[model samples]
Target: MRYLEVTVPKGRRRAVLDVLDDEGIDYVVSDETSGRGFAAVVRFPLPTRAVEPVLDRLNRAGISDDTRVVVIDAETVISQEFDDLLDQHSHGGTKGSRTSRQVLRTKAEELTPAFPIYVTMLLISAVVATAGLLADSPAVVVGSMVIAPLIGPALAANVGIVTGDDGLTSTGFTYQATGLAIVVGASIGLAVLARLAGLEPAGVDIVVVAELQERVSPNVLSLAVALGAGVAGILSLTRGFSEAIVGVMIAAALIPPAAAVGITVAWGMYGAAIGAAVLVIVNVLSINFAALTTLWIAGYRPQGLFEVSPTRKPTYAYATIFGVALLVLAAPLVGVTLVEFQATQLKSAADEEVDAVLAEPEYNHLEVESTEVLLDDDYPLRSVDRVVVTVSSSDPGPMPALTDHLHEGITTHADGPVVVEVRFVVAEDREGDASEQIVHTSSGDRDS
Candidate 1:
């Protein structure tokens, strides 16, 4: 069966439709008015490709003037099963690659995931995400990602679009939007309470920030990751590949960023919170865009038993959505690039200082370790801390001047006068390695 929807100017709709009726075309009509013109939609399902000749006939009849017709593939006819499948898909059914019809048929035949399970999954996700942020454990964070029930509303929005099921779509988005709001709200509240009770937020570290910072760069990589995960998600939905989809969920990293934003806000880290918020937006936009695009490309359409008019309005609506999504996906990348350029400049300054210090004659075996780069000003020693000049050979002689020079050089190089503590170890010292050396100072050194 084939479905064809045509849009005609209001003035010629009645005449064009009459010609279609006389030709024995079965179709339905809908009238939508734009600024100054009316769109008459005519839909019909025919077994054969009989639309082209009819359109040619309409052109000869002068009805084709200011009219456009498009043919879209509707895989299966509408049925009770189809309606139910759309509901399930839109309302957080399992990740599967089933054609929209297959999904419904399977739902009809199999045990569906119950509402209780859905709620449980949601709670589990929220709890896990919370714990992951507090613990600063990437493993825990990824686990939270795997368990997030956030996909429900996003999928519902897509299903709603394809099937033109407004209620299901709106309900789905509402649930998601509300759930996210609640989760983020509770997290911020918890953080505020903790601060009020004189509790410190978790350790601020790069790894933790990496897990939490989503909105920083909505770049090509983010889009690719979301798209890849979306395919896996759809495949899991259609093919029962739950385990793979779970990993995809983790890689996609949807929930942690929002939780991070809440925690950051509680800690009074506005910049971090902003970054986290960006991450949440990027993930949401990327996931929805990728998922819907994949579904549409795979030929999932609304399963209404009745045919409706095909108008530019629906197509334009989709285009607009895509345009917005594209912009969202592009944001993070731009932000990241700007940030990286700034970081490179800072690192260049620090590196030049390190090289100058290394050139000093006293320290022959200078080694610099600075794998970490600090992003936040609140934590002073982020990526900038340096360990220079490890003892490479045995030295029986005291080298006070050399040690002082190293300290002085570092202080000058870094621009800001950082507190410097020096320690010494004999090159062949067996018990105390350079890392665990004892410091000898006139005013007693501090090392704990």
Candidate 2:
């Protein structure tokens, strides 16, 4: 429940009361008040659901500027008349619960803060994300996501489009672009510092840590995450849920990729940086596109008729932009996906070949333990595939012949050239027990 104290000019008292009465709201009017412009105070208690519509109606009735409206939380109301009034106005739907245009506009305006605080949070999040990515720690990465303030502007852009607020849209886009620039720049600076401190790998070769690799190559799955997060974010905002949690979701789709771009850039891996940048671009477009679509579907629009057409123009423009961008991004994602698919197939074939080689007569005592296919360092561009085979045996035979046989088996199924490396783990029987044996290992690489 909310308690509203509204002070309007004497001439506008009836107008305010009429709106309240129309909505079946009960109020107490104190007329002939001794204050500025001989104003009157209308004190009303209302349900939470009715707050937005009632406030919007009041603002539309031209009492917003001159009227001083203060809303206070009401713990309890023990009036039968008020209860009856609420019962009379109550509807069995979400029509009355939707956030008003004024409220949404206020929220958007609040999100576009002064430059200093925005920059501070951006730099801080970037640094935190850099640390997390370097350490390859999920917990640290999530902490950075929570600290990121990027979601505000992201949703603000959607709000601006829905409400036809040019200033809001411009502010949102400006802040979002500026924030991203700061984050990327700060991350690059951190990378430079890390390099100076001997924290990151030197030369053109990137250390293929799990976190770094994940962001450097995006596909359809990454787009799906951004789309879902975007929808979740707008829903949280409209439903009056916690923005912080939703913000984390949005940050997850954004921050790590941005950090990856900086890290790759600092390492002078421009090609890999392109992948990370594409991921970031795809995510940004997907989030905005999803949020805009969700808001439009949720029945949010410009309040006035004149504002409606203008709102739609920008909506279509933004939608088209995002759609085209997504299409452009799909090319790279599709290529990456195909490369991954081929790699998977190659790895599977190599594993089968290793198993077949182990089943041969001379290698019957040996078992194929594990197999992995390592792609070229500059994958998707250079197409060299390395098949590493790990095998264990109690009674080992000559490795040269076995390596040649394994290589032949793999190359038969491989679409391109493959480098086969056989790692032999010779296990000796201990105390006449074959199952429980002491093991000695020797590795040899044979390229074909």
Best by lDDT: 2
Against the reference, the lDDT scores of all candidates come to 0.54, 0.77
Task: Single out the weakest 10-residue window by summed lDDT for candidate 2.
Answer: 435-444
The clash count for each model shown is: 19, 0
lDDT of 1 at 317: 76
Local accuracy of candidate 2 as per-residue lDDT tens digits, 1-448: 6688888766767787889888877788887547578467888888755676677687776675556777766888888767776665467532343455556667667656677988898889999999898888888989999988877789898898988877788888888788877878888899878877888643446548788887887667888989998898887777777878888988899899999899888888887788888888899999999999999997778765566787788898999999898988878888777777887888888877777777778778788878887777663233545777777776554467887777777877777666777776666666543332222212234433
Give the Å error, residue 336, model 1: 2.3
